[model samples]
Every structure is written in structure tokens, then in C-alpha cells.
Target chain A: MAKKTPLDPAAAFRVPSGLAELSAIDPAGTPIGPQDKESGAAALADLGPDLAALQEKLYAGATGGSEHRSVLLVLQGMDTSGKDGVVDKVLGLVNPAGLRLASFKKPTPEELAHDFLWRIEKQVPAAGLIGVFNRSQYEDVLVVRVHDLVPPAVWEPRYAAINDFEQRLTDSGVTVVKCFLHISKEVQKERLLARLDDPTKFWKYNPGDVDERGYWDDYQAAYLDALNRCSTDAAPWHVIPSDRKWYRNWAIGALLHQKLTELDPQYPPAEFDVEVEKGRVAAS
Target chain B: MAKKTPLDPAAAFRVPSGLAELSAIDPAGTPIGPQDKESGAAALADLGPDLAALQEKLYAGATGGSEHRSVLLVLQGMDTSGKDGVVDKVLGLVNPAGLRLASFKKPTPEELAHDFLWRIEKQVPAAGLIGVFNRSQYEDVLVVRVHDLVPPAVWEPRYAAINDFEQRLTDSGVTVVKCFLHISKEVQKERLLARLDDPTKFWKYNPGDVDERGYWDDYQAAYLDALNRCSTDAAPWHVIPSDRKWYRNWAIGALLHQKLTELDPQYPPAEFDVEVEKGRVAAS
Candidate 1:
């Protein structure tokens, strides 16, 4: 008999609906993974082949001109929440040809001129691709809210706007997996200090990261609103406990693997007469 | 003391100057790796960490706004010559975020309206990114020559134009690594048959591939001319013997690793005052 899989990652990591605040889930907890660090990384390694195979089927179909489905993983976290690490270890398992990655930093003058969703729309995964957005539409809600960059009237409606955008994506065969990498304030201090401690890591340090720490509570409030309002049947928010780097990597890898498995893309059947093709090749 | 290293991959794989015939090198030869299959795969695994580390430095330097250097890997070959396989196995060794891959198929009507290099130029690797062009500007010369799609006056002069284009890429802090995945005519027949026998791989089989097979000598002549003419100091062509899939993967992996190592990207120094930021982070 097959061993029972652990809890559905969908249910295990799904942010609860009607959530009141951000303090509910333990940032250090491993809700659906091995209880230790080494096993977490090992588990991620175990997922590589299956992930790659599934991705290839999808890639084959797309490149073969027969498929039009895609997946988009949206990553959101406060500064130093390990979004980049998750991408390297987790999403990195699949072929890059089938993957599209976009990182949204502060808006440039051109980006600022457009509607928030304008640039986001352009980067949505093409058919058969799996796209990742390092920081995404949620930024308009979180950062914009925390800094009062826009009045509540403007920021308040974006949750609905985001949900509608995600709904449209799903309607067009896109599966959206939005993850909020949850890290504690103490962890942020440690990560920043560690970056400062290593000369090789100094480039990762931004003084603004420390300045943003002062807005930790504000970001959490904004994130709570995002999770509660936008989490829907079409695309739900998954709060990946990111305090442990190993656990964070494992969880995101597991979630993405689970999503791709659910899609179960298949190679398109032979378009030509197989016997005729074989005869032609044999002769040539 | 360190162990003796193998012949410089740079020299071992580079196509000879003034090559007038495609038959000069055996397409099935493994000139630069372990003669056995298992060791070839094992060797690629050994290069993974160094490849990943070097990629991180380039990614960091670019993302951190301190580096302008990038590498472009242009892959050109006949159908089923293992270009896609090399990308999956060799280029796949690096971080996906730092890697940019562009697969150029036949040009669209809009693309045809512009100079051949227009589309190729737009996709050149940005600063701090390693880009792979699955099929590139060389197609203009190779296929255009074989099909007589353009007159001698037009296609013949493309060699000089390509040289000028690549030279410009080098002058702008780009290192171009051009590889021609050389597979024999017999191997293509075998590979096409293999795809026919395997149902799952049928998506990869194209009817036109057989049509192209009929033009083998014409294509080979075209290739030799393009290889000899376009092979330049700015970006020489590396003729990878690709009959053994394992060796092809290893050779390309080794060549790319060697190229990245040669670029020697550095992690940028601290852009902010470290002690001051440390104090701010600690206090917060």
C-alpha cells in the first residue's frame, strides 16, 4: 500500500479565512514538514525529479504548440524574509525555459505612471510557463498602506482589484499560489546583522531594510488585510513560516510541487502518423 | 599541490580556424571528458557548486547595482543536435534568477520587417545575467543560405555584419560564448526514430524535421561556411561533439563553467556604513 501523504499542503499552509491578526501562526513552527532542519532540506531534494518531470510535460506541451495553461507563484514578505532563497532552492527545481521570474522593486517613473496592475499584467506567466513574482501586486497594498503612499480610499479597493485580477488569471487557466513568507522581527535583526558580518554578503544589506523594520507592525497589519481579503477559492494565500531558512525552502518547494502535481500536465500525443514518420526516418 | 587540470576547455572545444569541411571532426567524439558515460554525468555534478557560487556573485553584483558584466551563450545547431538538452543539463546548473534563456524560432512578420539583429539585440543578457540563446543570429546565414531565401548579395554579407554585431557586444562588457552542438546525420535519424517509438516524446517530433533531413549535405555545407566565417576572436564557435548525450551535457557544462569562471564576477563591497547600520538594526 502507498504511504499516506502528509496533510494537503493546500489545507496545511492555507491562511485561515476571517483572520483577525498576524500573531496567530507561530513563525518558528513546522506545520507540515519534518520537525528538524536537515530533514527539511533533504525532503526538498527528494522532490526534484517529480517536479522536473511534471514541468517537462508542461514545457513539452507548450513548446510543442498544444498547451495554454500556466501557474504563477507570487512571493511577498517583509524585508529579509527569505523570498530569494526560496526561489533558488524551490522554484529552481524546474527547467528555466518553463519558468518566468519577475522581481518588482520600488516603481520607476514609468511604472508609477501606469495603473498598479498594468505592469503586473504584462508579467503574468505565458501559456505552459510557471511564473514567480518576488514582490507583487500585494506590495501596492502593503508598502503603499504602511507608508500612506496612497489614501485609504485608493489602497482600500486594491484588495478587491487584486482578487479580480487573480480571478481573471484562473479563468484563463492560470493557477495562482500566493505565499507570504512569515518572519519574526527578531529574525530580521539577525539576518541583517549576519549580512553585515560577512563581507561577501554585504551587498545584500540596505540601510532602508533597517528603516523599514520600524514599520514592522504596519506591514503585518497590511499583510493581514491582504491575506484575509484576497484569499479566495480561485487563489488563496499560503503563509510559509520562514523563520528557519531550511524550513522555508522546504515548504515553498513542497507547495509548488503539490500545485504542479495537481495540474498534472501531459505530453501532447503524436500529431503525425507514427508509422509514416518511422518509415521516413528509417529511409533517411 | 593541486591535481593536474585537463586541457583548457576553452581550447579543447573551440572550432578550428578556417574549417572548410564539417567532416573534419567526428561528431560522436568525446574529446574533453571521461571516456565513460557515468563519469561524464558525475563530473557535471561536481561542477554544480562552483557554477552556482559564481552565478550568485554575478547575480548579487548585478542586482546590487555594482556590476555591469554579463555573459551570453549562443547555441546554434541542426535539429536534434541536443541544444535543448544542453540547456536543461548544463545551463541548468546555475541559479534560475541569474539565468536568462531565449529560444528563437522562425521570425514573425513584425520581426522580419526589422534587421535580423534587431530581435537578437533586444534579448542580449542584461547586466549581471547569463543569457542563453537557443537558436540565434546565425540562423540568418545557415538556413537562409540553404533555402536560398535570400540572394548571395544579401546572405553572403551577413557574415561581416554578424561579426560587427558580436564585436559590439564584447565592447560593452559582454563575454559571448558561442557553441555549435555538432551531431552527425546518422544520430539525427536515430534520435528522430527514438521519438517516434516513444509516445511521450512525440510532442518533440516535427514533420519538417524529416524534410530538413533531405537537405543534409546542403545544411552541412552551410554550417561549415557559417562556422568558419563567423568564428571570431570576440566569440569563437565551440564545436561540441554531441552524439553521446552524456558527453554533450558534460562538455557544454564544462565549457560554460569555464566561461563563468573566466568572467570572475565579484560580490560588491558594502554600499552602506556597516557599523552604523548594525547599530540601527540592533537598536530597532
Candidate 2:
């Protein structure tokens, strides 16, 4: 039997440097993968070892030498868009030691008092780690705008602020991959219903989802604005059509696999002489 | 084929509350799992789904209701005993969202200025998460004692301090599982030589490992003292036979599986009226 090669989702789904139209993307579509769940899952499992080995090399590079590079994956989406699911199925493939995961909830009083970037800056992955932001600095424009939590004057400059911050991170050797998890309004309602129907998932449902759903159009407009504006050469955004859970997970896995391969982190050369170390160990 | 039945390691290897003997334990023995490497690995892989489900229930119980419980696994072993290996094979099976991992290195100036646990207290897992400490507060008694990093006056009282701190944690809803990964001195020598022999593993070799090995007897004495003094009803130590990598990983997985099953976290009941929420979601 011939070996099955998988899609390069980093290319298939990558939004060009500066533009995105969420409405044009299909929530349930498989942009470039196996057409069904089983094949998609098999392909995902195939990527695991390669992904783990690549992530470890990146980690080894930092500890043994001057490799300072890190990757930050920013997951942005409305509630119930499966940000958490993608994290489990995709990012979970690597050694957890290689991951620096931070989930941003509503701001605490201390966080609200600082510049929005302050807390985020504190959590950027250390050298050679892959950092994932569950929700991120982009919320300053999305949620803070939609809920009228802040006046337009307060939230308006955040798009420029985010771009500047990402550019600075890139300049310092951080490669940023931003993914917008796009699910349709109808799909979101079905998901909410499923959460209500299942005892296991009830904890995931928020009562406030109804209020958010009422402003669906407004949220979409806000998201489109943020998506269209904040992307750049160093920090491009990928629109992951996330209605199908398997495809979403596999796509993110493929994307990460591609980026890490491009980074091509080498195991740091031994700092100590091999023969001397061998003698020391044998003697011990 | 009849199903394979694995041993309950929580029962098999758990050091009885309040006592331990490091010298009596065999590092290469498979205390409970299949003796062969391939069979042991199969058993560990077989455990993934159940462990993932149990962990998710704990997460759900916390999110939807009043579950405040958490589990902390403390992993301590001499160099090259495979602490990192166990973490990848075991903890990496569950949802990464459910894990909070901290690796302790030599204290920084800031850490040294405070009480030994000042840095540790900051990183405990939140409600419903599983926290893994790569090396833990026990180091106050082990490494500190071996190297004479502190006067006995400073390190002597730490055994009682750790007990008091852990007792408080148990009373406040944390379940602590401590494991001392046991590997023979000969195995450590072999492993160090292997690292020296492989280019890929050179990054893991530290020249100081030889210095530490020179004090092997002192370190074992220190480890024996800590393990003996610290076992309690709420926090017992399990001495994992870690020379065989597959068995070590499987035993830890089984130990965790048993503890989580005993915890038996229930999915929280729906907070909203299921019927009303269904109506709302359907209308949305």
C-alpha cells in the first residue's frame, strides 16, 4: 500500500499578511484534508511523533545553546467555538514540557489596572517553548468592544497596540501564529443545545451565551475588523474553519508541524568533550 | 481473547503511611505490571481514555459546581531516573488544559531570599487541575542535606515544615501523591554513559552530574531520611522502580488512575434549567 501524505494546512488556511473575511470561510468545510472524520483522525495520529520530536529539538536548542526562538499560538474565537478542543487534540501531541499554556479569563482588578499587554508579556513562552494563549490580547478589541465594557476611545487604539506588540515579539525571535476559530451562528446555537442536552458538558455552557448570541452580528463585525487590521508579515493569522472538530484539530497540528520544521531547531552540540565525559561516567 | 488485567499500583507500591526503606526497594523490579517492556507499554496506552475521562469530570465538577479538590504529584529521583520520561508518557495522556506543571531548578536569588516554599506556593494547581512538580520541596531535605548547602539548623526543621504544609493542603482539599523514582547506581552510570555516547542526548549531560554522583551514598541517605519521615495518611510516597522505563511509566499511570477513580469526580449537574436552556438555545 502507498503511504498517505497529509495536507499542508499552514499554507491551506493561512490568511495572507493583512486581510481576512470570516463570512467567506465555511464553518463546516474541510478546506484541505481527508473528507471524513476517520481518515482525518488517522492522519492526525500520524503527525504525532514528528511533532513531538520537532518540539523537543526546539526545547533542546534552548538549553544547550543560543537558540532563543519561541512560537506563540493565539486562539481567538467566540464562546463555544472549540478553542479548548483544539488545544487538547492538537497541542497535546507534544511533550507538555515543551508547552507554556495560559488561558485568559475576564480580567482581575490588578490586570485591568495595568496596560493590557502587561499580563500577556509575563506569559510569553520562554526560549524554545511553544506558548499558547487560550484567549489573548485581541480581546481588548473584540469583547471589550462588543460588550461596551470600555468606551470606543479606550478600545480603538488596541488594534495598533497589538500589532506593535507582536512585531516587537517577532523582532526578538518569537514567531506568532494567530488562529481565528470561525463557527457559524446556527452552529453555535446547536452547540449550545448540545451542551444543555449532555450532563458532561453542562459546565461548559454559560448563561450569558444568550445575550452574546443576540449581538451575533455586532460580534461578527467586531471580529472582522480585528482580523482585517491586526495581521502582519511576522504575525499572520490563520482562519481555521472549526465546525468540524476533527478537521480543526488536524489542521492546527499540521500547521504547527510545518512551522517547527521550518524553524528546524538542531540539537545543541555537546559543550563537554565526549571522551572525557565517558571516562568520568565509567569511573563513577 | 480474554482481557488483560493490570495490577492496581496504588495498592501494590504505595509505601504504608509513615514509613519507607529506600535501600530495600529494587529499582529494576516490576512490582505490579507485565515484566516485559512491550506489554508494560501496552498497558499504559490502554489507560489513556479512562484517565482522560476522569480528569475531565474533575474539571467539569469544578466548573459547574463546587468541586474545590485538586491532585498534586511530586516526582523526585536521582539524576537520569527518568522523571521527564514519566511525565511525557503519563501526564501527557490527559487534556493539557487539566495539567499545571512546574519544574524546580536551583533557586534564584529571589527564591533564596524567601522561605523554601515561597516559590512553590505560587504554583500549586488551581481547583480541579492535576499539578506535577518535577522536583519538589523535599529537595530542602535531600539535595540541601547532601551538599550542605545550608546549616543543619536551616535544613533540619524542614521535614516537619513540609509535613505541616502538606497536612494543611490535604485538609484544604488537595490530594498529594508523592513518588521517589528509584534507580540503581549502576543504572545511573549506564544512563550517563549512554548520554555521552549519543549526540542527541548530549544536551542533557551536565558536568556537575559527576560531582553529584561522587556523593551518591550521601544523597541516598538523604533520600531515605526524607522518604521515611514524610509518609502520612494524606500524603504517602510510592517508590517507583524506574530502571525499566516502560514499567515506571505504567506503574505511575496505574497509580494515578486508581487515585482519580477513588476521587470519582462527578460531572456537575446543569446549573441552568435544562428545559429553559434548551428553549433559549433553540430560539437563538
Interface RMSD of each: 1.3, 0.9
What does DockQ give for each predicted structure? 0.74, 0.81
Docking quality class, candidate 1: medium
Could you give candidate 1's per-residue lDDT for residues B59-176 as a string of tens digits? 8898775699899998988899988888888877778988889999989999999989999999999999999999999999888888998889998889999999999999998899
Q: Which parts of model 1 are misplaced by more than 4 Å?
A: A1-4, B1-6
Number of the top-ranking candidate, with DockQ as the measure = 2
The lDDT of model 2 is 0.87
> Residue pairs in steric clash, candidate 2?
none
Clashes of each: 0, 0
What DockQ does candidate 1 have relative to the true complex? 0.74
Q: Model 1, residue B179: displacement in angstroms? A: 0.2
Candidate 1 lDDT tens digits, A162-205:
99999999999999999999999999889999999998899888
